[model samples]
Target chain A: MAKSTIKLRTKEKGGKIQVKALITHPMETGLRKDKKTGKKIPEHYITKVVVEANGKPVLTADWSGSISKNPFLSFSYAGSKDDTVKLTWTDNTGKSDSIEKKVGEK
Target chain B: MKRRSFLKGSIAAGAAGAGLAAGILTPNMAFADDVADNPFKAKSVDEVLKMLGASGAESSDKIKIKAPEIAENGAVVPVGITSEIPGTTEIISITAKNPTPLAARYTFGEGAVPAIKSRFKMGKTTDVIAVVKAGDKYYTAKKEVKVTKGGCGG
Candidate 1:
């Protein structure tokens, strides 16, 4: 809903690019109860993470409550310095966040 | 409600692990395709495999799970998995005795490496299994991680 709280980084070297992203979310599993309220916390977590470079699909990851709060994802893809990488995530409640960056970004 | 506010409010700049934020691309803010169903509902590792229609997965040395021996935060232990087996294409991480054993899954594409690294929440000290699908068969390797719940250990 709000502007993305995701941090992104992309680097290119020797005909390859590495992309890393960290998503900030509660990732509540609904099993953990409030210490005081004694009620189950509702399940909320990023369900799917998709990455696109130069407007083409590159990677997609599916996750569940098992993922830790504020999940970190890092992987590599073939690309050059000028290629752009965009990442988006959808959660169980349908809320979403996205961010994009070009390779070689600091 | 109060806890939610504290959690959400704490997400200021650099809160997402301090990764560099580059130029924001216009109109690239679209949500992803239909979200897949959560994999945490499956009760056991066997059930998780059944969901994928995979069976007879043999233990293999080629598959390696890199996790810490002592995890201070049971909720976020960085775990890495790599499969040196040729033709390794699909990978999944599972816990042997959690409420739901399967933690995550990935399908590699052309030229992609047979490796994955992500953080997983351990309900307790358990064997975290990394399974790789090469060709038509499945192979697995596991590591035991002792999770100190509630950060009680000093």
Candidate 2:
């Protein structure tokens, strides 16, 4: 299998779970022109991101191409150690990737 | 062959009826789709807010936006938003001068916090606005970030 495009980490501190994710994508806005080709780059960016904790959706984000390339996201939730956290993102082109991590795990 | 065609027609009609019933039973199902429809196409912050079902937002001090007053590079400006208001269900960030002003929208569930940190691209100097939805009211905060360089490619 190809390497995953998402890197996720979850840590439990003071009975709260901090989730951080880094996703690798170009996040093209379709307005940029290629320097060499002088052609516009087609728009391609993540449209939706869903973060679930133990099978329950804790956060749902809708994003546009204004987000920087190689997006980094950090948020927290009220969760305990050993709980599972899953993050999934779908781009405008229908491409998607997901990753899961267990809280308090290295 | 006639009998088979008749059965197929009946099945298709029944499926369509069931779908219509489900759509009517869950109005939120349609509302969710409406909310997700082309929000990025909005050219201004007001249009984006309208698309999000918010009429207008009042300025508030409880919403804190953390961003540099002057950014050397427009390619990546780190921003953090924290809403002190209780029962915040949604948070939206917009770059006022971008070609498309709407940047990101986040909906928090029961166990989630109403805060996030992320990076956004700035074409030039612009006002970064944060909108927070608590209960049935919407509040907003704004911060100006001067960009020395443009991030969008020519």
Candidate 3:
């Protein structure tokens, strides 16, 4: 099972639910060489992020090795305050993480 | 100009704009009429557009990519994607020079601002391209971000 590596927060204001998420990952580009030993670093990155509310996806992100080590994303939608928001990510290496947050909880 | 006709015209324009931003009709589908699978899987920038079924993109004066001329560290170089083009429904970021140039892709819902802020890793200095999809067309802009320290396995 991949780790639950997402930190997410939601704010309800002015009839909209705003969401912000931060993910943790190495996001390494399969380049660079070891200084001590000559070997290339493996490429590892979170390639996709899907954000859903009440099972209806609102945002989907596709990324590459060029993304930062850890990525942060923020967006808002016209959703009910009682909706459940879920975030999930998958990497190029086949590892993944997912988390669920209820809007009114925070 | 007749008052009622003018009002109806503006309303129709606003509705069209909304329809354009709502390009991502479903959560699992983006540009529902254009694609069925993920286009970001594309290894090259051109493939991304092709995946989206875009006719073609042209250099534009409205798309803006904000990044440092010299990023102190490659680990997390902040980048801002802002498109002034009207009816922008999607934005695609490309590291035109990355080993695999298609960096990131995003779709905006109707009425949401067409601006994106994120960070990307730089293996070395490279030109960053931003492709904005507005209604049925695509526009592009680019900037060169020089990385002092290699972020990718450099």
Measured by TM-score, the strongest candidate is: 2
lDDT-better candidate, 2 vs 3: 2
lDDT of 3 by residue, B1-154 (tens): 6997899799989987776666645554535543334555456667666776653688998988888999989778888888889888788888866667778888776445577778887778888888888988888888999888877664
Worst 10 residues of 1 chain A by lDDT: A56-65
Provide TM-scores for the models: 0.79, 0.85, 0.71
Q: What does candidate 3's lDDT look like per residue over A35-69, in tens digits?
A: 77766677788888888888877777788777888
The alpha-carbon lDDT assigned to residue B77 of candidate 1 equals 90
Best DockQ goes to which candidate?
2
Candidate 2 structure quality by residue, lDDT tens digits, A7-93: 998988898999999999999998899999977899999999999999999999999989999999999999999799999999999
Cα lDDT tens digits, model 1, A1-106, are: 5566798988876787877788889888767877888766788888788888877767677787788889998778667788888889999999998888878675
Q: Judging by DockQ, tell me the better candidate of 1 and 3.
A: 3
User: Each predicted complex: what DockQ?
Assistant: 0.24, 0.65, 0.30
Docking class for model 3 is: acceptable
C-alpha DockQ for predicted model 1: 0.24
Considering TM-score, which of the candidate structures 1 and 2 is the better prediction for this target? 2
Worst lDDT 10-window in candidate 2 chain A: A97-106
**Candidate 3 clashing pairs, residues 3+ apart or interchain:** A31-B153, A32-B153, A32-B154, A66-B121
